[model samples]
Target: MSSKTYAGIPQEYAKLETSKIVLIPVPYDGTSTWQKGADKGPEAFLNASENMETYDIETATEVYQQGVFLADAVTENSSPEAMVEAVHKTTKHFIKKNKFVTLFGGEHSISIGSIRAFNECFDNLTVLHIDAHADLRKSYQGSACNHACAVYEASQTTNLIQVGIRSMDVKETTVLDPEKTYFAHELATNEFWIDSAIDQMTDNVFITFDLDAFDPSILPSTGTPEPGGLFWYETLDFLKKVFTEKNVVGFDIVELCPNKIEKSSDFLAAKLYYKMLSYKFMGENVEDDYDNTYESKAQKNNVTKFNDDEY
Candidate 1:
């Protein structure tokens, strides 16, 4: 398993004690409705990552120099409720260790625990949700922990800012905040919508990215790929702004159902993960080899005060 660490880097750069980032793979898909095999998401991501170039041209930095430690994937729990509980406990443990924890999920349901843990660690956190579906059902399939209810708790506990959402039941409109949620159709040609979305967020941000946020033409391997979604470059533009303007404490990429015939989706997921890391550490000591020496500069440039005048 160690041979397949992200980017397939050597042990010197993947050690737990010296690493700046921790990658937690949650490979449990107990509640998927339409498609199965999402449990293989983590391995597919890791496998694709092994073939990635460490150097990122857009950010002009190789983020792996900061040391990305791939921890043991959470492989227990038979039910969605138990899986969520286990993920929360594991995520909390990592947060307590002061590590920048990133989660790769089996399904959208896994994010409930990760988001909860981030909220506990970071104050005034705003969840920057990028997904095709709202996943906002109050209780789906007889359980609150169902994939459809991934962010129900987040909506109640934290300031939820959803973007790229094109699918949702009308009943969920009750819970959706008009000011914070940006629907896909409304943002068709409006560049200003990015500012509108960012305006509702706090300085401390935790991103929950569902892979289906991309259009089916771009990433059709997800369980519920909706059409008319954000394409690759456009999505990156928003993400770069989020990482630059806000202190993204941590993020999770979920709901990648890998296909045997088409491996592009898996590769794209891996690239997205690495690109986010590069953006997060853009101006830090990311150029040189700082495997055991890099320190976080997230708070140095974050906009803590809410600029209501701009809004």
Candidate 2:
């Protein structure tokens, strides 16, 4: 959020009209229960991105060449409901322009708005939620917009598949679909988890990734750190497969509580964002047209809900 352009990219590629991607920064952290520094996540992540190498060794590509437009930060913090509405409207504004939208968050709660926008724009949308906590509560702390209820609406509307979850209250079990929810303990032993998760997803997928999904050993700067979480390569392996197999409409990464002393977490978040973009545009030429394939009329149609037995 501090840099003029994302990662200090050239002005030519950062223009909104020509850019294929739009990055929105929401620096609100009013609902996090434990850690308080997630509001600083976007600034820290941007600073780290400015210092990172643009060329991706694994993909043999410079994704920044595809053009990244850094939109103004959404600073609506007067109330949680008002903030979510602001994010929903701003995110939808970019999607309507046919740009690939991505967001950096203050906490998991921001996903409630981002996911809502994507679900309304795309047909049969799948929300692939990767996090350490279930976050399935319909309401928490007298607020439905709290971080704990981040994906509750997605659960009802989209083909919501949760992964890397290791901690949650017993009450969430009533809402979580066991067949689609991959717990961390089970993932460690399930050899086919990556493929299985992808198989359950619809053609259009929206990824809502919480930084706490990574193990505290590798990414300790998050609001809530849990044991038995994911590692770097394995996480990338799953994401690459998703980008390769499904139409990943857009994505959001959240819950980065940066520590003044530990800088690795910020760099990890930056690299993660770049890597996902690389996977998305690896095969496309920068000169070629980029269409996000969002349907404006789909906003009026209700996506048919499915029962567990339907799958």
RMSD of each: 5.8, 5.2
For each candidate in turn, the TM-score is: 0.92, 0.93
Highest-scoring model, lDDT: 2
Q: Give per-residue CA lDDT, model 1, range 149-253, as digits (tens).
A: 999899998999999999999999998888888999988878799888888888899999999999989899999889999999989989999998988889999
TM-score of model number 1: 0.92
Q: Which stretches of candidate 1 lie over 4 Å from their true place?
A: 1-3, 286-311
Give the whole-model CA lDDT for all candidates, comma-separated: 0.86, 0.92
Clashing pairs in 2: none
Look at candidate 1 and tell me the lDDT of residue 175. Answer: 89
List the lowest-lDDT window of 10 residues for candidate 1. Answer: 302-311
Clashing pairs in 1: none
User: Candidate 1: global Cα-lDDT?
Assistant: 0.86
